[model samples]
Structures are given as C-alpha cells and as structure tokens.
Target: MARAPADSHLTPQATQPGGHVPVMLAEVLDALQPADGGIYLDATFGLGGYAKGILDSAACTVWGLDRDPQAIARGQAMTEAEDGRLHLAEGRFGALDRVLEERGVAPVDGIAFDLGVSSPQLDVAERGFSFRFDGPLDMRMGSDGPTAADVVNELAEGDLARIVRDYGEEKKARRVARAITQARGDKPIQRTGELAEIVRGAVGHARGKAKAHEIDPATRTFQAIRIYVNDELGELERGLAAAERALKPGGRLAVVSFHSLEDRAVKQFLRTRSGDVPRASRHSPDPDPADRLPEPTFRVLFRQAKKPRADEAETNPRARSARLRAAERTAAPAWANFEEGRA
Candidate 1:
C-alpha cells in the first residue's frame, strides 16, 4: 500500500556528519543513469546528498537548486570539494531554466527532485516544521514569505478549513478551523506547542477511534499549514514543467514525494505529457480530431511508482513514506498547455 506522511520519525542512521542519507539513492541513480561528461540538476538540493551521489557515480557536472539560502550556503564546501564540478543556486526549482541559463549551463542530462521539507529543516526548531520542538510556528521553506503563524492568526475560519482539508487531507478540518479561529481571538497562535494543543483539543485523540488512531492529532494540520506557507504543490507542478524544458532528449527526471497529493501530481503530469490520457467511456462520444492532444514530451520509466524496501525503511524511518517516479525527456517539443487538475 502507498504510505502517507504520518511517519516523521528520523532514525539515527538517517543523517551522517554533514548530510542526511539521500532517500533511495541507488534507485534514483538507476533512474537518472548519470554518464560521464553529462550535466545533471538536483532541483531540490537539500544537503547535497543526491548531488554528491550523482557526482560520484560519474564524471558529470551537477547544478543544485534550492530556495533556502542556508542550503545554498551550506553546500559551498561540496562545490569546493568537486573542484568546480558542483554549482549551487539559491532559487525554487520552478525557475530552474532561468537559473541554468544564467550560469551558462545547457540542457541537462538528468534532473531529480526530492519534494517536501528536508531533514535539516525539520530538525531546526526555529523553522518550526515539527511539533516535537515547541518553537515558533514558522514553516516557511525559504527565509521569505508569510509564516505559519500569519496563516493561523489571520485566515478566516472557512479559509483555514479549506487549507487543512485540501492540503493536509484532514477530515475534521472544520472543527480544527473553528477551534483555531476561537483560540486566536484571544491571542495569536505563535508557538508550535500552543497550536498543537489547540488542534489536539479540537480533534480528539482516542487511540482506537476511526481517523484518530496512531498518528498525532496535529500532524495533518501542521502539514497543511506548512504546505500552504511554502506553496509546495504549485512549486512541484512548475518544477515538472521546468524539468521538461531543461532536459535534453533522453534526459532523465526523477522525483521523490512523501505524500499522496504530490505523488498524484507527478503521476498525472507524466501521464498527460506521455500521451497516456484515458479515452472517453463507451457511453461518451470521442473528441474531434482537431482537439487531439499533443504528442508526449516524456516517456515514463515505470508504470507504477517505486517505494523503499522494508529493510531500508526500517533503518531510516524517514524513507518509509518516500515514493519515487521517473521518466525520460522525449524528442517532441514541450506541451504548451498542460493542465494540473485540482487535488
């Protein structure tokens, strides 16, 4: 079965001295198929894990992109270690084409995106990604933008419910939203612990109850707030498009998504761009030939997404929910009007 983001546990083996283990390194390598003299892009370079792996796997140049300036700064050592083979850029992956163009890098042979919050971001209490640390409720992936506290304290009850429902997939989003609105009336919900308690009180935590089993009550709400604050889903869609534009023919693209929503976006993007759209049912008439879809721009590497083996998940708990999907850029011109349907 496909896993959710309920498992936020980080095992000791998950990170080494300077970097965390790249989830599904071997699998991603196989999908990317890095070759000598080829250039690759790590669109979500958190700690240079995938970048390092790609550089080591072949005599290729790696250009890493990250929205977080801290990530870009931390990766300088890796750039030096590679003796100019590694180049780190500070920006969202959606702007990857521009970043590459500015750096004089041509269309790359492979591009990889490991979506969602990184381990370092989750570990830092100040970033407020996890409730385990009781820090300020700021979940911005980058240094800019509105913080989680702003959303919690300012959004209307209905808006809050929508975010919790749509992004977090929380069933009790109405109750949670109402509780938040009520609580914030007295004072702004500033700290992670305070907001978590509010959510717990709103959504009862009965161990055996339906939708209230093992996961913490605040998990879904936190995820929703974080995703909203970062505009992660929108970023992923644009990143996929940018990858299409930035990849050479036969260039590979691999993405690792932790939740079902992100995985669905990746699946649909590949399906639509690969000309695998479903035909109208027997009861419905076929479309006109003039309205025919464009040719596929990418060839999917696998019919189904791949997951980590049980042993790997057991060793690094964070890998438990990671889902990998890969594809290759085709010779056709990019689809100009690909639609990203609602989640």
Candidate 2:
C-alpha cells in the first residue's frame, strides 16, 4: 500500500527511521483484525507501510505484491528483516490470485489495497506521475506499457477529449484536447511541464480569470492521462474479482481509494457482491425464479466508507482525500456466474 508523506502526527516517534506513514493505519488495522498465525496480503505494497504495520501488529505472514520492480527491490530488506515473515512479489494486484497460486500459497486471512499513485511515484519527477517537478511525460506505473507522452502525442483530439472528460471528470476537456493537439503539431509533447503549461493556458484562458487558492488547471488533465496510461480502472475491477477468489471464508478485505472513480468502483463491487443492490419497486414486474442471482460472496463491514479524522487530514494533506471501505468474504463460491452476466 502507498504511504502518506512522513509528516503526519500519527506516525510513531519510534517508528523505524525514515519509515513512510500508512494512511488511516489504525482504521485499516481495525478492519483487518490481523491475528497470530494468520496470513495477509498487502496488494499494493508501496514502500511496505501497510505490510510493516500488519507484521508489527501480529505474529503473521504477509505476502506483498507490486507491479513496479523498484517497489519489489525496495522491499527486499524488509522481507529479510522480518525473518521470512514477509514475502515480496513483483506483479499487478489484479493478477494477485495467479501470483499467490504460483507460490503455492493458501487463501489469506485478509487483504489490503491502497489505490492510486504512490507518494514516491508522485514525488520523483523523473517518474512523471506529477507535474510538480519538471520531468518526462512518462506516467506508466509499471515499465511495460505506453507512457503519458504517447497518449498525449499520438491520440486524436476527440479521443483525448473523451479520456480527460471520462477519466479526469474535467469539464474543459475539449479545450484541453484542442490545446494538446495544436501544441503537439509544432513538436511532440515530451515533458510533464510542457503539458501542464498547455493545459493551464487552455483552461485558464477559458475561465478568463483565476482565483487565489484555486486548484491547478492541469491537475485533472494529469490525473486523466495517468489513469489512461495505467489502465487503472480496469485493473481495479480485475483486482477486486481476484481478491474474491483468493480470500478464504470470513477473510477481511480493506481498500483505500484516493479518488471518486476508484472509490465508486470499490463501493459498487462490494454492494453487488454482497447482495446490497437496490430492490425493485411495486410497479416493476417480478423476474422469473429460474433467473435468480447467485449467493452473495461478501458482507460489507460498514454502512458507509470511512474517512480520515480531521486531525490526520490536517497533518497530512494526502490523507484528506482517502476513503476506506471494508468487507468480509462469505462462504459462497466466487462470483464466476455473476461476472459473466455483468461482462
């Protein structure tokens, strides 16, 4: 799981030197309830914050997975320090079931996913996850796929507009796309700073004026491009399904999402799998009994998603947007039939 910047008051004064603080650590622990001799999975495993927390909480084993090779390399010392209690794997969380199966691991007692770009990814300008510092427009989370530069330079204006509008939820998507296409026509847009400037010019001009304390005009565009470059939404969908298959009955699942898109996906998945779907009104016709839905595979742990305390949010700006949702796996079989219908 990704950790917040190391400035939060929630961090232990005696925590390992240079440790990154996991967001909502106490709440996540409460949801997972890690116990002795049990196994847990830290599906994101960025900087090993959640994994370390789980290890410190109980005499349990933790399987850490990350798509980024750099993250896996960073975890080597932690794995060794844990005396074989922590195992690190390099793979996307969406393929977690396969990763565990290849290792001959059993179903886990709990799983945690901290979604969105990690702090390191955002802080390192060379990684291109943020425009805060100038860098190449390469936002691929893992090294395998196309970069944000590829999307910005190669995609059609309409396609770019669609991505910004759909993924970023930006209202000025068309203007942004037009600006990108016009600018790229002069030369390939290759840097984060260049794109940020283009977006700011486009949106800022449209607004005619800027207000103090307003968010950067380029924030949504950057978010949209990053999400597109990483196929984040699709990965989240697959990861949730994989988690369903990997978890044991009564096993806990906790997901922390940083944005509405991710949080909505998590919320909808839990609601549908837990049979919390909306009921039909009296005016609606009843469906045939033979078309009955499959048994619920999960039970939601909370009626609503949890947010960080005001103090924690004040201390760490990153934690302000975090939303946590948790649920426990049911004995019912994985939702293979249900997934097919939905697909």
TM-score of each: 0.91, 0.93
Q: Which candidate should be chosen as best, given TM-score against the real structure?
A: 2
lDDT (10s digit) by residue, model 1, range 40-108? 999988888888777777888999999999899998888998998999999999889889988889688
Q: Could you give me the TM-score of model 2 versus the true structure?
A: 0.93
User: Global lDDT for candidate 2?
Assistant: 0.87
Candidate 2 collision pairs: 1-45
Residue-level error in angstroms, candidate 1, position 333: 0.3
Runs in model 1 deviating more than 4 A are 1-19, 208-213, 281-286, 340-343
